[model samples]
Target chain A: MPEQNFPQGTDRRPFADGDGRGTRSDHQARPQGVTTVRRWSNWSLAALVVGVAGGTAALARTIPSHAASTTTTVVPTAGTTGAAAGTTGAAPASGTTGATTAPGASSAAPSAPKPIAVTSPSGVTTYVMPGTASGTAAGTPAGGVAGTGGTTYVARGDT
Target chain B: MTARTRTSAPALPDAWQDRGDGGPIGVAERPAIGTTARLAAWPAERLHDGAAAVDTVLDALDRQASRFRPDSELSQVQRSSGTVFLVSDGFAEVLDAALRAARWTGGLVDPTVGAALQALGYDRDFAAIDQDAPGAVPQGVPAPGWSVVALGGRLLERPAGVLLDLGATAKGLGADRAAAAAFRAAGGSGGVLVSLGGDLSVVGAPPRGGWPVAVVEDPDRADAPPSQVVRLGEGALATSSARCRTWRRGGRRLHHLVDPRTGDPAEGPWRTATVAARNCLTANAASTAVMVGGADGARWLEETGLPARLVSTDGSVHLFGGWPRSDEAPVDVSAGPSLSLAAASVGCRR
Candidate 1:
């Protein structure tokens, strides 16, 4: 009769008497129901934690070393030579390579790519190569003496 | 006719001068591309035609590569951040030369310093920049690095917020272009010299004794005699100086040459670098790299086997890679009239 008085599906048991103590059967049923619910919650929580940890570890393994590094790749155009493809790191080191203080004395010689002269239909000559040339044939003889009559000036500009 | 005395001023229309020796060479100059453009052509009659050709090349270059121009192709590329953009052949050629210079110089001469330049208050033309403007100097912003830019054929792609400034190579390319065009305009027979600002290029056949180039300390001081005079048989000559195109911000003087690594004006023992190479673009790149490379630049220049003249901050001159020495004594400003020529004709034959 007391059990029938309790609400259906309620885990909370009613007091058996004025002393506020649950009946013997009510107390026994409450502990088993609580343990069962707590065990299920713990298992679910543990599975979720394992899944999340596994995912994080997997993601950590997939990252590339150079993901943080900046890389530039330039495909050589029609007339360029030397390193058909080149890649420079994020921060290029200064004065370590490419050039030296003395001619023909560089320990780390820079690549010297000859420029290919391309003559357009409009008579414009474009140097298509990217690197310095071995020599040019357009100037006066290299040994020609300089004269005073027709001298031009080369200086820094405002641009 | 006796060669009329030439004044060290921008030689516009009426100012064209004939060589006092009455040689076939005539010199003409005009303001162009935010700087002065000078043309020296053989057969005095060809000077006008050469000038026209030079103008055409410079105008085209300005429209294609100027960072200060809102509608320039470079500016459009800047705005297209993170998008692939197709470039014209001319733009691609100039850009290729810039990248090659970057690669050849080990990134010492970078084109990606546009943002850094703007941050330094050089966002507009040098003449328009106010040195005394009130503002705090912004923190140095290292360039995005040239590596961030990708160019394949006419296609260019870069990350968001990357700005490209072709100031390093565009002028030289323009000079080279102008010289070739001028040479063609001159019937493609006689020699033609084109100097945009101080990037000088020559094509066809040089004069009897090569083009005599006066390497001066400061281009603005055109009236001051040069420290050295060199001869370029065919190639190109470019001079990069920290003393020119300078401004002040936050009480500190800044120059146009920004070290992409530091995002600030380059500071070095050498105040100026003048280089001669097989072409204008190469010459400009080497000279600029020398200025930006600072103390290490001299050695770098020597390695390239190109002739160079470097002026120290103290005004001392050092020459390398077979750069001819000046026979004439250095002019003293204190000694009046001796500096009348503006540039002393020191025979640097060979």
Candidate 2:
């Protein structure tokens, strides 16, 4: 789909009736041949305003489960985990969903839940999250996507 | 929407905490002092999938429900009196749910309160509300009940006199929508949990049992304990709190939990009521009702057959019927593996 460059009040239907100008007059609503940086700035600012007010209020988010030291897999985007207690899923060996626990396994009271180790694909920068677990790495592969990564997987009894 | 930071694909870890046993197993822990989470995952990228679902719904909300954008249908109706802007299913559903809640709450939680809320010091994000700005809440005359904002099979409403404040319900609605999307994306088998701020909903089960969740301290309470843990799965939960807002007037403190009868801060026994329903909106409506209905509200929720956990002003916890239960035995904080993909396969392209 091609984008459009609509300017302010581009529809000239208001002047079509010839209240102030006749239909034959060159009064159609259209922009001049030249464009100014100021116009783009206004458009950008308006978009930013809408984005912040409209998007952030409902956009994606995550936080530690304060009520429970629940294990969060922060499953890498596109990977869906389901009931594969023995990594029995047709997918990867992890076989977990939304970065959570699997079936038929004893729960381990690890200091911090172990984070699986996944090295970033080539050229995909790996960003380490500060102030979080340092084991079994979680999070997006790209560097600086803090919210994308899972907390480091800490072995049981090892904080 | 703050230009969402474009995140690249995430790298998966090499191993998870492993337990040799292989049946559907459930695990939980107290992340904070009070909050608890029980998790059952079959094995799919549930978190990322869930977040993706949230983003898609939020994108639609912007296009359909936004009043901030001048071109939005909401804004159009706001500008014209007695005019009904036929809206899409998504927008209409949100408005319908909001109105239903408004009427059900006896007008205490009205969307039209947007004007009242804006006139108050909360014109911006709660974070931006000035603490020292001195009490100067613009007095707003509460409008008619939601019945005044008509609705049928199609969109019908004169929004000029009534501002639709789906603020409280939007989160709940969004959570359900996102969870549904995630479930669909993941082929609709494994358990799914969608938590937005304080509102959350779940579907299916995790790997083994259900998803455990926690009710954390009021971001305002520095010394608040985190013992509050609720086992949540296959339903939704929400909590409303006024600890985040207060107005000082002649030694009395006013909060945001408003009561329509008096159009003032709610007088109540419980500070927070977390209700679980099939969807987040229902949970939210119940939570808001608790703040307004007070003791009666708690009873009302119990009567409605929805599971509820109400925390009183004194920190006592009341659990309703039908709430999920861990092993009536002591909850094991940890003793199981995160997930294993052996018998049950939870991760398949949805």
What's the TM-score of every candidate structure? 0.61, 0.54
**Model 1: residue B18 alpha-carbon error in angstroms:** 8.8
Estimate, for each residue in B117-197, the C-alpha lDDT of model 1 and write its tens digit: 889887876666796766787667799788777666556555667777788787887887889888887787667778777
- lDDT by residue for model 2 (A1-159), tens: 222334565332333343544333233323231234457778999999998987665543323343243444221111132322122232322223223333322243111122111000010001112112212122223111111111121122211
**Model 2 alpha-carbon miss at residue B37, Å:** 16
- Give the count of colliding residue pairs in each prediction: 7, 100
Candidate No. with top TM-score:
1
Query: What is each candidate's DockQ, to 2 decimals?
Result: 0.00, 0.01
Interface RMSD of each: 21.0, 20.2
- CA lDDT of each prediction against the hidden true structure: 0.59, 0.45
Q: Which stretches of candidate 1 lie over 4 Å from their true place?
A: A1-159, B1-23, B328-350
Q: What is the TM-score of chain B in candidate 2?
A: 0.73
